[model samples]
Target: MWMLVNANGYTLAPDGGNFSALVMDGGQIVAVGATDDVRLQYGARVDRVYDAQGATVLPGFVDSHLHLAWLGMQMNMLDLARATSAEDVLAQVRQRASTLPSGAWVLGANWDENRIANRRMPSIAQLDRAAGGRPVMLRRVCGHVVFGNRYAYEQAGLGIHPANPSDGHFGRTPSGDIDGYAYEGATTLLERGIPAMSGSELERSIAAAIDSALASGITGVHSEDVRHVGSLYRTMDIYHRLQAQGKRLRVHQLVGFDALEEYGEWLVEQANKQPTIEELDWLETGAVKLFADGSLGGRTAFLQHPYHDAPTTRGTAIYTQEELNHRVAQVRKFGLPVAIHAIGDGALEIVLDAIASVPAVAQRDRVIHAEVASEPLIRRMAALCDRMIVDVQPRFAASDLPWVEGRLGLQRMPYVCAWKSMLNAGLYLCGGSDAPVEPIQPLLGIHAAITRRLPGTSGDGRFMNEGLTPYEAVKLFTHGPSYAIHREDRKGTIQSGWMADLTIVDTDISNSQQLEMIPRTCVLQTIVGGEIVYDRLR
Candidate 1:
């Protein structure tokens, strides 16, 4: 049966003119043109007609980078994101401690040292007092560092003495005692005590993440939580069952590089077992993700110069160039794409070199969080053209802008978040919210790209000169990401023979002034593969 969808405004194709109506049959767009033309073609045989009621319909958002399972787990954990001071963090910890078992591990995330009143890392004594000797680990907002209580340190069998702190350091006092601040490798000490989620719990979390994305107008995402690999298989099974009963959401999974050794053989075997396309348009494996360095927030982003705040120290590198090159070569040999986490200038250079080493045929090599790329590297990236994809988070400008200027200094600030440069260089730009790091809402990201200002700030907007137009921002979240994952032929734009994945909003977002109000605009509906998975009106 055919479905005719008529709207007041819509972008029918990336380069084509807007249209008033579209027709879908068998989960694929059959035609996109005038309402009269669509109605005349399928008016009599149409199973249903959807009126957009003047909303602006466009391609559904594609979040190319995110950890869906972890975001779900965050919903149940103690949220320290709102804690404004060290005292506030301790108070929340103490309040939650009273209800838990005496020896239970207290794990929480989303705390920033810059936001805390003290402007300093939390101490072991402070966490110990709050938790009453229970093992506790609170991750910084960046997820690259952790603050642990004395009990956690003891449980992990770590001593006060720093063990080759260069790799990652444990915060210590003048007298050589653990101060609870764990940077880099030191964070692993607390990971041992955190309990793993059951299969059912994992499925629930994945469902919650999907629902959350739908509400935010995110129809699809490329997930990177390898820790939940088992959970992914379980979630896929559950999704298959749900679809059999007629329900499911679209998802694309990417395995992390760390698990490549343990699961590489399995993925190679399962690649042949992939279900037919008709059975599932909602999930697929697109790439292998690798981390080249840590995060900017932790000052471990692997840079050429020392951190502005910590002049004595440059950032840390998670993997050597030789190791990364070997891994990329191995993964490329399997015909799978590779996406590397690279935030700093030095890290980006290394990843780019590794890509250069790969054969030209092995394309779609992505650099996630290409936040601080240099001009030379941008030129090198341009040479790859469509082969190189950049997965960037625009929302970071609002949260990290305050500290970014100080980190890179005024001279280098202009080069940061170089979206315009990438576009000018002819490279594909894929926008994403590394959710749990930033909120998963695409509009927030759109707002960031167009505004380039921190929340509640009135100053000449930070990097206002570098901001992108609303149309470009929307394209980044839509066609750009689809091209990144090599799915532009099937997803991305609303054209004939393409998957009917789309989002409808109340306002015209192409205008810059209109973008400021995007967050308030309602997502009237989200359709995936011709199925009305999320409809606000209903």
Candidate 2:
């Protein structure tokens, strides 16, 4: 059945002017033109007609980097995103612990040491007392760091006496006693013991994530959660089942690098067992993800120089340049694309060198969270053009601005969220929420990109001098990201022969406004595959 959607204003393409109407049939956009012309062509055959009532309609947002299952799991956890003191964190932990059964793991997220009044990582003793002996583990906003109570550590079989840290570290005092904080590789101590979600539970969480995303105008996401090596098959089965059920969300799953090494043979075998690309239309396999460094919020991002506050420590890197190059070569040999998680300048340089080693023909390789890219690196990135992509989270700067400035100093902080610079340099940039770290709202992200201020910043309302225009910001979330994942031909823009994935907004977002008013710009309707998945009017 055909559908005719007439809106007062419609962005037919990222840069395309507003249109009055669009027509869709069999899940594809059949035509987009004047309202009267579209009506004259398909009005009789159309099964439904939607009146947008002067709202702005555009392509549904494409979030390039997110953890769908984890975001869903976070819906039930303690939210400490705005806690101003360590006491606030303990209080929230204590409250959650009081209601839970004995021995049940109490996990939480979004607590940052930088924001705490004491400016210290939470200790095991405090959490132990808060939990009254119940095991507790709290993840930092970046998800790269974790803090555990003594009972939680003991349950994971970690000893009080600290051992030599591996690629990542377990925080310790001068006396070599475990101090609750665990970074990167060390997070596995507690993560290994946490109960795994069942397939049904995973499905439910994914569905919840999908609904939440649709409500906020996100029709597609590139999820990068490759479960543990041993559970790869089970996780893949669950994903396959979800796809078979005709899940509303479009997903581009990137296989974890850990699985590539631990279960390489099995992964290759499974790849061979699966049908060719044509047969597996809903899923694409051949993208390997690697974490080259930790996150800035955790103060673990690899840096060429020491942090402004922590002068003695220069942060850390997971793989050396040579090692990364070898891995890149190996992945390319297998005809797979590589997506490296690199946040700091030093880390990005390492990844860039590895990318340069690969043949230029391999397109769509990306640097996830290319946050602090330098001028030279930006120039090199421009050379790659369509081949290199960036998955950026604009909201992070608004929330982390104060702390980031404090850590990097004012001179270096301006370069933290370099969206405008990247755009000017001709780099393909994709916008993502990095959910569980930030709320999954593309509108909020778009606002942050253009304004560089939180929703309620006082005074002149300028948080960062370097910011993007709304038109450019919209491209980052839509066409820019679509191009990154090689989906521009089918999605990203509203054109004839494209997928009918779109969002209708209540206001014209391109217009300048007070920072506070940005979040209230609700998505009135979200349509995917020619179906109205979410409609505020109804």
Candidate 3:
């Protein structure tokens, strides 16, 4: 047994209080209480003890939504997210181009046109010059759009003038030539020409994400990987290997979204091949993922009305009402819970109606990015106990909220990120960083949730009244995710009989005055299953 003493701990219990010591043995917390008494009883037999040095400890963060594969992909790829202008991005691209073999693909991710000082999308001619004649592809931060160089267009077999898809688009110049821009599924055309990652390369990336998560004090993550990178078997293979190596991190993977016929067939084919487990403790999946719409940042999110800024057009819809209902019901027939990406209000209405149509087949069905749901939609979601959950990224506010108000206007801003209203309406809320989309750091998430402001930025919050309290905000990353996933009884809290996963920090979060420091708060230690996985002070 081991004890963590000389500190403050927030249990996230219904009847919350301060605890001084946390005692654990064999991957379970044995006791938690005042240091003097609990230590007096267990000190004699305790084999090891961690002195907190008067810091604040809490249950380790459990992020309910993120793409670990994508995060890993970003870690090793060309990152244009920080480039201040188009020229800066091109300068970096040229540097990369100088090193790669000619004709080899140059891939990049996280490029946002809005962040560029000129606010201009890079043109194909500019990209060609930057890549020095090599094929180049880069995805927008939202992953809904892509930019490619002339060589990439040539490799993809695109013609001089390419017609756009009915649901998505490709940019064209005044001369009617392909502009090397692709939106939505059209981006996949260019992607197909790129080489796929090797199995060992994928394992290395997943391993990278695991180490990053642990270092950030994350104990568990509800991740989506197979959809973007490789096959489900490939994704789970590395996870199983990690478990075999005794490197365990709680992961609830959501099956990738694809066409109804293909995804359905693959599910049954992989069922018998899946490795049997004593319980779904380390890695498990019973949830099927779907994409209902695009992202707000890309101006592709389905909305009832046209964007206030882009009044000429409303956002794109991945599926219509009937299409969604029919597909959702068919997916439910397989007995798998569904999680859909529904960012705009139009998508929410259709998704909620779809879930409502299906009689409760599972304990939880998730609404990823319920970013903009209206009042009536909230009420309807409350009625549906298909246990529909709202998986949100508060840090998204830090990024999107800055310009979302301009797109939505004041009349619509209040309804956006109305987390308080959703809770009052009896809807469940869980937090995720949508990492690589946002940083996967939970303290930054907590800061964003409570403050609704970008860390280090000085101003009134984007929507100050929509912000959550410190306790409520913390729950988004803790009990809220556990309950959403139906694992609350065993995880998500620091208490007796619960899983021994704790995150220790050097500051008090409950003080309210310390809220601004939440993002800056450093992780002193991360303990997972009674074992020290990450310790910075050491």
Best by TM-score: 3
In order, the Cα lDDT scores of the candidates are: 0.78, 0.78, 0.83
Model 1 TM: 0.94
Against the true structure, candidate 2 has what lDDT?
0.78
Clashes counted in candidate 1 amount to 0
lDDT value, residue 352 of candidate 2 = 88
Candidate 2: worst-modelled 10 consecutive residues by lDDT = 277-286
lDDT of 3: 0.83
Question: 1-538, model 2: which lDDT tens digit per residue?
Answer: 5654557555537456878888887778888888898888888988878777778888878888888778888887888888888889889988998899988989898887777887765567888899988888889999999998888878888878646456688888788888888898889766776777777777677777778988898877877666531355655666677767756666777778767764466557867787663333345544688888998888889877789888887687988898999988887766678989998888988998998898854448988887777678788888877687888998876787767866777777656888778888888888888886888999989888887777766644234556887777887788877787677777888888888888788888876663456678888888778878788778
What TM-score would every model get versus the actual structure? 0.94, 0.93, 0.95
At residue 203, candidate 2 shows an lDDT of 69
What's model 3's TM-score?
0.95
Which regions of candidate 3 deviate over 4 angstroms?
Answer: 259-279
Model 3: residue 70 alpha-carbon error in angstroms: 1.3
Model 1 whole-model lDDT (C-alpha atoms): 0.78
Residue 334 of model 3, lDDT score:
78
Ranking by TM-score: 3, 1, 2
